[model samples]
Target: MKNSITPSVPARGPADHEVRDQIVAAATEHFSRYGYEKTTVSDLAKAIGFSKAYIYKFFESKQAIGEMICANCLQEIEREVRTAVAEADLPPEKLRRVFKVFTEASLKLFFRDRKLYDIAASAATENWQAVQAYEARVRTLLREVLQEGRQSGDFERKTPLDETATAIYLVLRPYLNPLLLQYNRDTTDVAPAQLSSLVLRSLSP
Candidate 1:
């Protein structure tokens, strides 16, 4: 009888999960220290004490590792914005808080780690999955805030929710997008409040 041979597959147990986390952690540190564009999967493997093939077992490529780091960084900004918005009692305040908090968070990130920020900038420019997902969440949040304002009689009910949200998102995009943020540094401190005020006036019922 002929023996049937099956291809070997990587195990997905707790140990494997730990190793994957370790790899991601290592990659994040490496990318933060040395810009993502200059790093290679082979370099990462050497830095992390793993073979290139073994690293591939955990992540498909260097970009996959970057995606994880980028997603985590974006999630942190989203969390701060969400928390600040939740703390405000009025819908207008919530909307203003969203702009203020998000801009502040982005600025903080840009200054703290320029190298890491470059990854986010690249992700934004490329419209990577992480950036797209982050943008969608922000849009949803804006829509919800507008809906709440209309229901509370603080905002006009004339404009459609999606359209209003998109409009506001476009206004905020320069500050929120990493790729465009560096150019707007001079206005970062004052722009969010001014823009939010302008938006609030338009929304006034």
Candidate 2:
């Protein structure tokens, strides 16, 4: 019988969140530079001076790291939208500001980094739950804004709050979708101001 070879596992490092943070930071650079499909655990480990096993200790897989980066990016987007919504007094103004903030931030985040955009695009298709969860958060934010509009007598809704929010989200899909944003760079079919007017009119009492 032939002798079997055993693979050696990397020794564990300090069991602190710092190690995880380092992994994520290094992974972000590698992912942004090399695109998601080309990046590997070994590449990340080599960049960080750790073994692939060490990376696995912090993140279950390369996909998990990608998910973390996506989550972080989405969180930042959410924070900007939330800040804009919170500061605006009028619901129409809040909706407009939120739309502007979301569009500007997303464009800056994705278009400025094509590799990141590619990763996000892949995640939207493959890791759909992450995308859905992010959308759910946005929908909840929209619902809150709609509720405020209703309370302020700015909106006369024939549909329920959740349904109305979903409708708004679907209506704004072209603007909110990253892939569509990338493809429609030169297109002038729908302007931001035009969409804002449509949304305001739709919501008006």
Candidate 3:
């Protein structure tokens, strides 16, 4: 079912660790399949072949499991952003790379885990721990990249790192909306080279 779900968290570990991981894995699967409101503890437990009580011991509730799953997703997003930021050689280039990398990862995730994706998009407003941490981590990466750009005199906006990061988010945010998917399921609208050209032109002095 659904391409034979394979959980990222490993399976063979200490019994306790395996149980916890299995619960997380099961929750990820169910959430990816059914989303937040529809996914239930029993479904997760059955998916993992664990008793309901066993699941509770590892996670107090579905929301707890959700936070854990979101944390995992955030960690993944941070990794991708960090990679993109690390690879770029210039400020304008960094923004372009970050946008492309973030967009590709998001589109992949949006299809695989739409609810969690939405959860992250609204995390700033929802005040969810997972979302908060996720945004914080992304901001940290942005700051680091901008600091490098500052040394190179690449950023002329005089905006604080946080403001600039939010601005980037503003620029990239609309593409992640569900409606945008109808346009070639995450393609079209702006080809990478064109988007990069637009960003470079706007950001360059």
The better-scoring model by lDDT among 1 and 2 is: 1
lDDT value, candidate 3, whole model: 0.61
The stretch of ten residues in a row with the least summed lDDT in candidate 2 is 1-10
**Per-residue CA lDDT of candidate 2, range 1-205, in tens?**
1112121112234435788778878888888888888877888788879999767777777877777777778777777778877788898888787667777777778788888887788777684455667787778878888888888899987778888898878766556667777775554244556777888898878
Residue 196's lDDT within candidate 2 is: 71
TM-score rank order: 1, 2, 3
73-93, model 1: which lDDT tens digit per residue? 878888778888878899999
After superposing candidate 2 on the true structure, give the runs of residues whose Cα lies further than 4 Å from its correct spot: 1-16, 187-190
TM for every model, in the order presented, reads 0.90, 0.87, 0.71
TM-score attained by model 1: 0.90
Among these predicted structures, which one has the highest TM-score?
Answer: 1
Among all windows of 10 consecutive residues in model 1, the one with the lowest summed lDDT is: 1-10
lDDT of 3 by residue, 1-205 (tens): 0111122322223535766776777777777677766767887777778888877776777777777776677566557766766666777777777667767776666567566555444443456666555555555565666667677777655666678766665565544343444354545336554666765565554
Q: What is the lDDT of residue 194 in candidate 2?
A: 70
Predictions in order: lDDT? 0.83, 0.74, 0.61
Task: Name the best candidate (by lDDT).
Answer: 1
Query: In candidate 2, which residue pairs clash?
Result: none
